[model samples]
Target: MVDYKLELIILPVSDVAAAKAFYDKLDWRLDVDIQGEGGFRAVHYTPTGSHASIIISNGLTDAAPGSTRGTYLVVDDIEVARADIASRGIEITEVFHEAQGGIPSVNKEGRTPGLAPERASYFSFAIFSDPEGNEFILQEITTRLPGRV
Candidate 1:
């Protein structure tokens, strides 16, 4: 048997410096920034308490800038997290929840204003984007689903 862990996500950006600055404003930890020969460069960032990391670099991926979407960041409290981030000067969408009989989506197909009724975990979310328009979703999850941990 073997164990595998998700490690890194590569984000394509037109300007590495702008992307780096955006993540810095979010207060995510900047793990590393390195420049290599032949004009190679990579800037790594990790959200607080996250096991995985994201790398914004040149030539590591072929995806276009702002193509990344629906990347979810789990939080214990969506409101608090949203407020904290909004205070950081980032524009985030108001907290929204999946309506009954509706699946969660990056689009606002079945989303309702404010938090989920009674504040259920994994049902509420807020959205924001980086300078490159890379979309990120912040989801509330106080308790993990079975086998998630």
Candidate 2:
């Protein structure tokens, strides 16, 4: 065994302070705050009762601001999540579907399930970019039609 359950996810940001503020508005609690290395410090925070955590670190290399990657969040209520996030003064982009063809089934090669596209359905979601230009998506799986997986 690896002897480890999940650890942490570190994201590089141009401005640690601004990144911290953005996450703060999301109601995330800070776990670690270390800025003693002449602004080379990093901040750690976690979403309650989750094994995953986000760590915003000062650029240790050539990485620049808004260089972070995308993150997807599956929420119970997309609208509520959008409203709450927007109310925090965070900029939210438009919400739409990615045009998934349909739910995935057995793979062609039987190796793995590569892509399972989502089509039009009762529920909807949206996508938005963080201050650092990191794309994030909010999705809601509301209803499961009969005989549809």
Candidate 3:
């Protein structure tokens, strides 16, 4: 049995410099930036405390900018994580939890007014997007369910 790890995600952006600057503002570690022949360039950044990193590159994929949505970044504390990103001048949607029926909402619809009243793990979330509108959700998860490592 081989263990597989997801180490990187490719983010599509129209302006590489602007996207690089935006991620840089988040204080993510800049791992790579290389310019190759024929206008090819690749940039890599890793968020703080994240084992997974993100790549923003030219000539990488055919995916459209801002097309990726609902990508999640799990956090131990939703408030702190939200505040940190907000303080960096990013506009984050209000913290929200799923409606009482246990079905998670899609995008902005069906979300309850505020944080999970019970502070339940994996229930609270905050939303934000990059310059090109690639959506990312910050989900609070203090404890993991079975088999989740």
Candidate 4:
């Protein structure tokens, strides 16, 4: 078994500058910005509380465009959060129910579907892909224990 805390998601891009601009527009804060070191350039960003880190890099040994790499950002309110993100021009991915305890559950198509709903866990989430086509998700958990579905 492996104990994991912090995570790093490295995304390769053809144009690092363009990728940085797109993420910036989303109001995603940028971390250390290093350009031109040993033929590698990188820019890092992490959501609040250091849930996960996204690294935009160039001149990497591995990784290609449209490579799927992402994380889940938990949210409190899925509808409100999805609306806010939609206003920002990001699209949600899927809304489905995970069965537990012989009960059926539902969540918004993108940012609201609570993962493992039967567990009564809060995990309202939304999925979005970067400009380079790498997909990631934001999740928010509100309540614990099953609610009236």
- The candidate that achieves the highest lDDT relative to the unseen native structure: 1
Q: What would the per-residue lDDT of candidate 1 be over residues 92-134, giving only the tens digit for each residue?
A: 9999888872346755778899988878878888999888888
Per-candidate TM equals 0.92, 0.68, 0.92, 0.67
Among all windows of 10 consecutive residues in model 2, the one with the lowest summed lDDT is: 107-116
Model 4, 1-149: lDDT tens digits are 99666677777887788888877767777878898856667889876556678788877537786585545666666556667677777666543333332222234322234444643444334577778787766555566456522
What's the lDDT for residue 128 in model 3? Answer: 93
Q: Return the TM-score for candidate 2, rounded to 2 decimals.
A: 0.68
* Candidate 3 residue-wise lDDT, 7-63, digit = tens: 989888878888888888899999999888987778999888999998887668899
Indicate which candidate wins on TM-score.
Answer: 3
Model 3 deviation from native, Cα RMSD in Å = 1.6
Q: Model 4: how large is the Cα RMSD against the reference? A: 6.3
Clash pairs (backbone) in predicted model 3: none
Q: lDDT of model 3 at residue 37?
A: 93
Tens digit of per-residue lDDT, candidate 2, span 18-52: 88888888887789988765668788988644567
Task: Score each candidate by Cα lDDT.
Answer: 0.86, 0.63, 0.85, 0.63
lDDT (C-alpha) at residue 73 in model 3: 92
Return whichever of 2 and 3 wins on lDDT. Answer: 3
